[model samples]
Target: MTAPTDTPSATPSTPPDLDLAVLHHLRGDLEGAEAGYRAVLAASPDNATALNNLGFAAAQSGRFDEAVELYERSLAIEDGATARLNLGNVRAALGDLEGGIAELSRATELAPGDPTAYDNLGQLLMLQGRIAEAEAAWRHALAIEDGPRLRTALATAVAATGRLGEAAGLLHQALTLDPQFGAAWAQLGAVLLLRGDVASAGEALANAKRLDPDDPGPRRHLALALLSLGRTDEAVVEFGELVRLAPDDATSRVDLAVLHLSAGRAAAALTQLDRALEAGPDDDRARLHRAFALRELGRLAEADELLQAIADGDGEQADRARQALVDEAS
Candidate 1:
């Protein structure tokens, strides 16, 4: 169906069409919202609200550069904090960590004490392996909030930095504050694993799975805990179930393949890795695992071909492939 085709009739308040787009956004119809916003922009390129919301819509749709342009336009009209924050989010999502941090740094200048901004910084720092800076950001957020998500972020930050006990405590606190928080339970399990508390880790992971049946995180953690605890058969069954739940999640499939390899089931691992490769034809991660599994199975020629494809920049595995070749030579 077409939009209402209504245009703004008055000034000082937002356009009726802009309101409709926000409604569409609330209903999670991003495409519908995008269409509405684009129509509004056709008449008014300098509509800051429309441009800001449209940039967010584009970012959600994976058109990061388009989102960036819209954000810049919106900021040019008026220095909106959300526009800067979203530009930073899109930049981080596109793997430009330094650029993302720079954008966020500017956003902080605009709104010095925004918790969401700091929280975003923490997540980006974590991704870039800047554990110390990530922890500092999360702690700054903590001074303002003990919300479940903030706690979960704190748990991830601390756990990544080897503070497993503190991480586990934070996750447990988050879960205790809201027993239905699946993400907190999942993180708690992961922290427990780092502490070598396999049994408790399995329990917390099971709770996470129960709380959110659609989430794959708990299953993966449970599989890992089982494997580390010498329950290989059980771990294999759990990993197999993960493959069924998220058939196209290449990373989970790689975890399953690793489990199979550890259990001396190279052929089974190869089959799983093949499924991952098929699902993500251009995924360096799947290719890297396949090459290693093939090497272990004495298929050196096939492994070399796969690694060569990686080294030739067939995908994002060039760095990993080059390193693997070096390791092989040594």
Candidate 2:
């Protein structure tokens, strides 16, 4: 007969707590995740893995500064790749762009196969307008493995570089592998629009909306496609829905304002810029839009004030803003 074994005692046990914390995080329970991670820390004070994982949970919950401190503590104990990635992400969120870039720039070298590091680097590069480099990094992520969730990412990078047709092809391939890929269908619609095929774009965009009715990205893009195809009334209604859903989305707000401005609705454009400025005060793009709106409304003084700031190198958004200001002044 086999001897019966007693259950393991709980004294000094931390792996159990760490496992539980990860489980809670996966289940989307932030409060439970925090409690479990803290419990693990109580038992294993210098456990670098537990500390780094704890920092990831904190960052996901939007406690960015606390996350950075935890990641730093963990790194001091053990120079881990994951901890560095988490630290870089926190720095990115805190507006320390160069610092964030530097840390992420080093993460892949420390752990070459880290998908998160590649994705983060790709996103940061996209933000910097280095589309070619971003595409390469995102492609590297796709080559790692035919995982369950990487196709949409690859398609995004492909599309960003004006290769929408390739993105559409990948989205189709993704759906063939996983029909539940809602974002893929939506992005496929964007690709179709760039290919100048509005009918197909509508179908793809409709499929995306069917899969995820609550998301705003598909609907907003569908609206743009509609406008591009000369369906003005439908576009207007779609834009209205977008504004209702994401009142603080400055990009969508600016797009809406541009549509109105193009149609000679200066007052409506001003209202959109008002909302954009309120949501993104430091956004040079929104400020430029506001200046454009002011100029259209014959408010040259207000326009000049904003334009002068852009020319003074408050923060260089693009060459056009600086040139526009110079041209107007001369």
Best by lDDT: 1
Residue-level lDDT tens digits of model 2 in 229-276: 788778877787788898988888888887788888888888988998
Query: How many backbone clashes does every candidate have?
Result: 0, 0
Quick one: best TM-score, which candidate?
1
Models 1 onward score TM values of: 0.71, 0.66
For candidate 2, what's the RMSD? 9.1
lDDT of 1 by residue, 1-330 (tens): 011112221235988888888889878899899899999999998898898888888877788899899889998998966777788888877779898888876776787777777788788888888889888888887887668888888888888878888888888889888999999998888888878889999999989988987777799899888887888888888888888888988888888887788778889889988998888888787788889889999999999888988988956779889888888889
Give the clashing residue pairs of candidate 2, or none. Answer: none
